[model samples]
Target: MILKKEHIQELKNKLLEKKEQLLKESNLSHSIIKELLTEPSYDEVDYAEVSSDSYNLNILREKQLVVLKEIEWALKKIENNTYGVCEMCDSPVGLKRLKVKPHARFCIECREAFEKEQKNSR
Candidate 1:
């Protein structure tokens, strides 16, 4: 394994734990959205409170979903023997970075470049 056996196990455990937490949170947000959308007083309810809660739920769900997607991607990378390699620069992302952010697909330098590009685009 590119990762030491122990490290690989730890990564897997962390990803699984995070995945479950995200799924639960995401599902709860989705359920709330559905409830709000189909509320009994569909037209009579206070739009401000409902909209505010929905907006907050959306942001939270969005962040959690992104993390879930990243974890899934990382797991696939591990299966493909491509884990720990930077997707952008093709450099090995050190174990320390992987430990800190197991879903990281790029090294610090490449990540910085990518973020800069993203900021410019926005």
Candidate 2:
């Protein structure tokens, strides 16, 4: 089915909102890391806690970076008039799926197949 322009616009807006939120989180994570680096621990336990917190924050930031890239890709597809099309089969990704995941790169079938392939490869 052909996607309505209004629906596409709504998905675009959602993507933009999510992108902004992720960027804000990324900046906050950076500031937190900086703060963690500058603060000195008085004891070994305190130092260990700080190290753990920093490690977790870095992981979170890395995840956010991946999402940011996906959002950027989606926005670019929207600009190119290719939004909501599944990359694997060149089919509509469906409005429901797009609403749930604005950055989805594949349709449900393709996604499931891709996941199965990855699982089998492991």
- The model with the greatest TM-score is 2
- Candidate 2 residues lying further than 4 Å off, grouped into runs, are 28-53
RMSD to true structure for each model, in Å: 9.9, 10.6
RMSD of 2: 10.6
Candidate 1 has an lDDT of: 0.70
Candidate 1, residues 46-89, lDDT tens digits: the string is 22344577787776665665566678778877888888888777
Clashes in predicted model 1:
0
Which segments of candidate 1 are over 4 A away from where they belong? Answer: 28-53
Q: How high is the CA lDDT of each candidate model?
A: 0.70, 0.74
lDDT of 2 at 112: 88
